[model samples]
Target: MSTVYDCSRPQERKDGLAAAASAVRSGQLVVIPTDTVYGIGSDAFSLSAVHSLLAAKGRGPDMPVGVLVGSWSTIDGLVLSVPYQARQLIEAFWPGDLSIVLRHAPSLAWDLGHTKGTVMVRMPLHPVAIELLRETGPMAVSSANRSGQPPASTVDEAREQLGDSVRVYLDGGPSGDPVPSTIVDLTGDEPILLREGAVSIEAVSEALGGVQVGRPR
Candidate 1:
């Protein structure tokens, strides 16, 4: 059986965070609210949990999952070497709605799918998400919906799609609008805009001192 916790209540929020953290640690999936949309997440280092997350979404390794971190410093440990531009972007738009793709540290023992030695990472601006992430460390997360369906904006919608696949649902109320985080790929020589979302391309360029953002592929 699965559980849903109304995070609006103080006690439920505390309990939900505990349950969600436990679920992640045990290689089970959980749904949590992010600044962008509801996300289904599992322990980033657990291959079985990652497989379950992908299967629940009807997705494949080709469409790799992204990782959500709790703090600004977390990215430093996830990537091979945080580039200067990545640092600038983190300083300018982190804990907001920017997701950056960078080369993962080869020493790490996790697989987020056919990421080709790279990983997309973000630091969300939701307190519940941050609280849960702090307890669980980095998590493999993706939109809480089937591969071709709309992203979930509430825990109810997420539960409807993911069902018993997710062990816990942390309801942080309605997620307002479902704007996705802007994804910028910094794995190449020049920064590339993989997806233009909540954050604008111009803002990204401005943050990097007018460096041209490459067109989406």
Candidate 2:
């Protein structure tokens, strides 16, 4: 049976976080809460763990997953370049609802689905998620649900979808926002809005010094 952790208590939260981190270190999948939704995550550097997470979600390798980091400094090491505009956006909206896609560092070893030379990255605002990331380093995380299902916003929802496939479910109460993060592509000259969720285009444009918002090509 999967280990379900109640994060409401401080001691339980720390214990759960430690167990989840240990799972990730051992290449096991753990479902943790994020600012946007529950995410099923594994160590970003573990190829086997990445594959396991995809299989657990019934997700194809072509659907890329987002890499969750605890801080902005971690972002620099993972992606090739954080553009000036992207940096501004990170400064303004990060640890909140923004996710940026950039060219992946060539030396990185794991495959996050079909991302070839690119990576989707975010620093989630939720304290539990951040604590887990800080402990496990970086996690290859995607919304906790079956491939085509709506993302789970609560631990119960994640349990219903993932169940025993996931080793641990960190319950940090229902996510503050049911909507997913606003995904922006920063690899190109003009910012491309991939998925509109929490962050609005106007906010992103203002952060990038009035750069025109364009649809993802």
lDDT of each: 0.95, 0.90
Residue pairs in candidate 1 whose N, alpha carbon or C atoms collide under 3 angstroms? none
Candidate 2 C-alpha lDDT tens digits along 4-80: 88999988998899899989999999999888888999999999999999998997898988899999899989988
TM-score of 1: 0.99
Give the per-residue Cα lDDT of candidate 2 at 132.
Answer: 89
Q: For residue 64, give model 1's deviation from the true position in Å.
A: 0.2
lDDT of 2: 0.90
Please list the residue runs of candidate 2 whose C-alpha ends up more than 4 Å from where it truly belongs after superposition. Answer: none
Q: Candidate 2 at 72: error in angstroms? A: 0.9
Q: Residues 1-217, candidate 1, lDDT per residue (tens digit)?
A: 8999999999999999999999999999999999989999999999999999999999999999999999999998999999999999999998989999999999999989999999999999999999999999999999999999999999999999999998999999888899999999999989999999999999999999999999866
Q: Model 2 clash pairs?
A: none
- Give me the overall lDDT of model 1: 0.95
Candidate 1, run of 10 with poorest lDDT: 172-181
Query: Residue 139 lDDT in model 1?
Result: 97
The alpha-carbon RMSD values of the candidates against the true structure, listed in the order shown, are: 0.7, 1.0
